[model samples]
Target chain A: MGTGTGLGRVRGLGSAKKGAHHWWMQRLTAAGNLLLVSWFVISLVRLPNLSHAVVTDWLSSPLVAIAAIILVANVFWHLRLGLQVVLEDYVHNEASKLGLLVLLNFYAIGAAAVAIFSIAKIAFGSAA
Target chain B: MSRNHSRPLSPHLSHWKWGANMLVSILHRMTGVGLATVGGLLFAGWFFAAASGEESYACFLGLLTVESGAINIVGAILGIGLTWAFFTHLFNGLRHFVMDAGAGYELQTNRHWAIAVVAGGIIATLVLWGWLLWPAIMGLVGGEG
Candidate 1:
């Protein structure tokens, strides 16, 4: 598992070039998730209450909104990349793997859009 | 660009004895999925509820909170599990960061790191839940005693 062989070694096909890029992105997003999620949890716990007004007010801050945007973006990207690996590894059927991968992309984008839209509505709108 | 039908496949799970490292790998994937599905819904729901208005917000909270007024106890359970998943994923993710950097690859060291990931993730999850519930617990104890 640690080493490669034959044509793959010569051509750098599977785990050499493109795979390296995926690996890098995963690590990059992992680091981002680590920092942003910490900020998210801390900010959440520190809130005086979880009421609508309180939460909206908290998210209205420019800094919090920015951090949240980054958090959402990184999380979804990391999740898509991670799930891609899972599907690739376990899904032997080519058609099913491709369909699932497409669905995964759409799901991540769609979900993140909703969350980001909600955050934007709070941050840009008049303080609640 | 030729596929090799005769090429050997990757080793099956049964080939190796189960270890924490394997568990960590599986947990990372499971928790990742759980967070994206359950946690993402909660994340979006909270924000959307807040933006929608007080009524909608209250409706959402009714599903999320632990009060008697809660519409669904399962939501609360899912929320708690989401928190644990988040923390565990986070801690284990950091351990993965070290591994990604091309460190801690030795057999013994890898196992040790895997144990740390599991222990640390669980401990972190417990500590967070404890902190969150401590106030409520104190109120209950105070009322009783």
Candidate 2:
């Protein structure tokens, strides 16, 4: 009884082979976002005000600087994941969906890179 | 027994997969709600800082950090809730992308992944809080000396 047939036996049976990779990526991003968001909130809370000097000073700290960079990157990456699903669900046209996905990834990656780079320059350039 | 179109019995929740896809769907909604709220708060913070002088900004800061106060309480609640929303959404969102790629549809594997996500979220939150609060703790200790 156990030695069943061919393809029919596997139809809608078990694991979706690729699902674990998605699961793992989601978990990884979640973990990263958790750390980044917490740091961002606390840092924002501690900041004195909108004063340019104060804002710069807050951002100048090595810890805050690095965290900010990470936070921005994580945020964009997370946003990409979210918007991808929204696009997939709503945009029926295959071309449009694929285009949106590509645009989202490009925008996220570019924005994150810029944010990280700018923060790094501001935080470290003065010293050098 | 002619045709009856009322509906079949609902499956037990416990027996349901409650797996990656389900988890991701739920988290997307949760995070959307959270992000909306947080976005408002964020803009408000900026507005307050811009409008009032340094003193007012300081007051806002004090309200957030001061112990045993309404503002602090609200801050704490938002902090935890937002953290959960962010982590859950991020993790589950990634899961959705992977599913789009056609993966992880196994029953047993899905269950394990769901459990892992929840556990991972909790642990990550704790670690983040610890890192963020360490400086404040050190400041308090130094002040006492």
Candidate 3:
């Protein structure tokens, strides 16, 4: 028998040292979501119109555009982290879990990319 | 290294009575999944429409919140559902982070926080929609008077 304690023997068998980083990032992004989402909700409420031109015009503002980008990025990252914990806890099949996790990452990245691209298109496109 | 049969297998839902805390925890995960999947798709669509041009953007707006019609009814319901999901998940997630910081572990406090998350989420959604519809409501009132 190894001299190490029971938990010590089993610890490294399941995971490495990087587990804390996921927890930390989840919390950090949660805080970011709180702030950015508050801004988003309040901004939407204040908008005078939801019409295409007016909405796009509002998004064109530099600060709004940057904040919107950051909000979507942080929101999606936080979302992915949360879903990961659920999947890890519930998924019994190793291969299936791995497949779903890979898909989740791509989905989040792709969704965030589309949102950022749309914001950029509006913010930088011709004023007319 | 032999498997210890004495260790109880994974705890299943049937083994324990359902409680408010458990419900909130389950909902937190469920909403997170919903937001990532369904919400993400609509979000991509919104951005794509905006980037495409004014006509497409108008169509997207019509698809979501157009006033008065069958499509409007369906879109409104989906919009409200999405809004509620967003608020509930956001609030409950904050509560989870707070608990992670080593507080609110007492049974009473845990239940209270769970209830707060539920109630607060509903109220937040209502107030947001109320603000969004305030002008329309006022317009109706003005016309009636």
Candidate 4:
């Protein structure tokens, strides 16, 4: 509520010194997921086949691999932020809530890592 | 002091009138959770299978496809359910963005948007899947003839 640019104020970097950083990032990544996931669906639909070779060939392209990695990152980030809100709302206990939040971080990061690694592997090993 | 102070409680679900808006609001969360868990794992599995080599990829496809190369029942169910969830969340999320921009608060407007979003999500899913599953549909249709 205090003086500063609207962006700084919403960022909680204003004189009031509060922010909606988490909430802001959630919305930001949601926008990303919307685009990336749509690309995934449409691209898959356009593919001639779902066979391993076709899929691998698709991901082998640098552009496709990059997009897939970006999609994975955005999806996992949004998943973490969205679930964090749900867990915080429903889990009343401080300790239990913290634990679940921590576990959520692990799962999101791990899954994203695995997915990205797979794409990179296909790009380097098979696609090459 | 903590024990002596009673926390104020907000009204729960029973306090609100149930409507399409409420249903969509709840489903946004429900479908989000479903996609985060089942859809997330399945996505990771697809990538992992592809990276593991041709044999593993074939094995993974085997789980999703039948001898006729049509999607198996499990695959079809999961595919439909996931698509519905995906589009529902996507549409409802777009609705939230409009609301966040400080419009669409009228009761009639909200109700209409809720109905439209739910219907639009289903129609979008069917349209996309219909195109993708045309071969499978024809396969089954030919058998009946």
Give the top-scoring candidate (lDDT).
4
Candidate 2 CAPRI category: incorrect
lDDT of 2 at B56: 56
Give the CA lDDT, 0 to 100, for residue B52 in model 1.
Answer: 79
After superposing candidate 3, which stretches have Cα over 4 Å from the reference? Answer: A1-15, B1-6, B67-71, B134-145
Residue-level lDDT tens digits of model 2 in A1-128: 23455555676778677866754664577668667776676667677543545765676679877777677766666666656666776788888888878987776676666556656655775453
Q: For candidate 1, write residues A9-93 as lDDT tens digits.
A: 5664344447579888988998898889888888888988777778888888899989998898898888888888889988988
Q: What are the per-residue Cα lDDT tens digits for candidate 3 across B1-145?
A: 3447888788889988988898898888787888778887887778778888988987877876655522377677877788888999989988988898899999999999999998887998899888766767777789642
Interface root mean square deviation per prediction: 1.2, 7.5, 1.5, 0.6
Residues B17-110 of candidate 1: C-alpha lDDT, one tens digit per residue? 8998999989988998898777876777777787777899888887766565432568657867777788778878888778767999999999
Candidates by DockQ, descending order: 3, 4, 1, 2
Candidate 2, residues B1-145, lDDT tens digits: the string is: 1224596766765779655546655667667546534643443353334234456556665655564322366667777677776666656656655666688778786666676666667777778776666766777789642
How does candidate 2 score on lDDT?
Answer: 0.62
Error of 1 at A18 (Å): 4.0
DockQ of each: 0.65, 0.05, 0.68, 0.67
Model 4 per-residue lDDT tens digits across residues A54-122? 999999999999999999999999999899989988998899999999999999999999999999999
Where's the lowest-lDDT run of ten residues in candidate 2 chain A? A1-10
Root-mean-square deviation of each candidate, in angstroms? 4.4, 10.9, 3.6, 5.4
Each prediction's TM-score against the native?
0.86, 0.47, 0.86, 0.88
lDDT of 3 by residue, A90-124 (tens): 88788999999998899888888989999999899
